[model samples]
Target chain A: GENVGLHLPTLSVQEGDNSIINCAYSNSASDYFIWYKQESGKGPQFIIDIRSNMDKRQGQRVTVLLNKTVKHLSLQIAATQPGDSAVYFCAEISDSSYKLIFGSGTRLLVRP
Target chain B: GAGVSQSPSNKVTEKGKDVELRCDPISGHTALYWYRQRLGQGLEFLIYFQGNSAPDKSGLPSDRFSAERTGESVSTLTIQRTQQEDSAVYLCASSRRPSGNSPLHFGNGTRLTVT
Candidate 1:
């Protein structure tokens, strides 16, 4: 079975500080990894993604790091804001499968 | 361009009853997927449809759950003899294609509450 798990269920951070959410995946064949943000009463939104070939990828204010050797993935948010408070999930997909396997999710709470 | 659309933002059905949830993917997208999310839980893949190929239903929880897609436009997920444990949010997502490189865009989801 393919399992993707997060190290922490909930992470609280102060505004203007950096936040890092960690995820561990069991499938080494997973070639693509993605980070998603889901707010209350909304669907999960794509934040950033990193391919197996790349160790890191960056977006507007977010960065995704993939360590294929350890089968670990991470999402880093710069200057965390109150609006960034949401549930974050890391998903992985292998070349053999079309579906994405998602982790349980980490709740990000930012204090003003 | 409009994003993926799901109907019946919320559904409440009694146990033993059946319910149908709908999804309309983005016009040009050729892939659609259905997932379930329990309270404070992650997305659980249920089914996937791509182009004209047979849908991948390996993720479906049981025989009580089934889904259908007409071409690449619309999809419907049906649950039979729903149980209280079936209460969850049914989310629909779509991608331009089935490739791993394509990112899936999601819909708000239909929150199903089975009593």
Candidate 2:
């Protein structure tokens, strides 16, 4: 069975600092990867995504780096703010399927 | 212009009862998905519907879970004889297409608590 999972369950960071969340996936055929931010009592929101062809993709204040060779993915947030506190998940899409396999998720806690 | 919407934002039911969760995806979207998230956990892929073709229900935890979609529009997920472990947030999402390039638009989700 294919699975996408994270390295950590929780990450605590100070405001204005940088935050990095790591994820590892088991499926080598996965071609698309996405990072989502889920706030308490809300749905998962798309943050950024990277394709297997590309190693990196950047958004406003977020960056997603994919290492297909290692089957690893990471999300980096710059100048973390209190509002950035939420659970972050990494999802992978297989080349043959439309389903997105989500990681266990890492909770980001920003302290002011 | 609206995003994905789910009905019965919160549901509470006794054990052995059946529950239906509805999802209304954004107009014109061709792909819909259903996921479950238990407390302090990640999104569990339950089912996916792409266009009018047969759906991929591989992620469904058990036979108690089933879903249906009318054309490429609204979808309903039904849980029969729900158990306490069935308590979780049921999320629905829709994408412009079934391709990897398109990101999914999600609804707030339906919280189901089985007591």
Candidate 3:
């Protein structure tokens, strides 16, 4: 019954612009969150992750923000590039189990 | 050469046939997971294996599905009497620990199509 959801099914952004994708999760008990990127014909690749104890985490060019009060999570990509075109997914893992539930992906299309 | 590995990247078979998908986790990873991704849908958890503990099969859809793992090694998911609805990408992922906090490393899935 753990359901993680995305706010949008797709997003379009011009190359070099910033892109933001949002996700909503139902489990308040979940303590860990991760963002992944999947390219055509490839599996999901880990981009960044954050613990519930922290509100935000940053990686090379991606940032993950978690809002426990609203049960919302978002991923921001800076200076989006054409190579960044892919489906993005947010996953959650609760303290009770090792299973990581994934949300429906948001496809990001970057126009060069 | 250091990531999860899956075999038979693609497979096609008749509806009545049986198919097995294989997953090889990273060298020292102890947690392995199997998930199904249907067209236009999110990944559906199928099974999980950790160290020497009993595998958690809660996510399996039916009795037609079965999976095996030996001592944190390779895993095989077998589907008996596969149906057309079984057509999907079977994704396998592995994590270094069973702490439920580590991020997972996924392998390109095996795309199965039951005609």
Among all windows of 10 consecutive residues in model 1 chain B, the one with the lowest summed lDDT is B50-59
Give the chain B TM-score for each candidate: 0.96, 0.96, 0.94
lDDT score for candidate 2 against the true structure: 0.88
Off by over 4 Å in 1: A1-8
Point out where model 2 deviates above 4 Å: A1-8
Clashing pairs in 3: none
Candidate that scores best on DockQ = 3
RMSD of each: 3.8, 3.9, 3.8
**Candidate 2 residues A1-112, lDDT tens each?**
1111233478999999999999999799998888999887889899998889999888999999988888999999999999998889889887687888888888898999
Question: DockQ for each candidate?
Answer: 0.43, 0.41, 0.44
- Which portions of model 3 miss their true places by more than 4 Å? A1-8
* Pairs that clash in candidate 2: none
Please give the ranking of all candidate structures by lDDT, highest first, separated by commas: 1, 2, 3
Q: How well is candidate 1 docked (DockQ)?
A: 0.43
Expressed as tens digits, the lDDT of each residue in A1-112 for candidate 3 is 1111234388999999999999998799999999998876778899999999999998888899999999999999999999998889999988787889898889898999
- On a 0 to 100 scale, what is the lDDT of residue B37 in model 2? 82
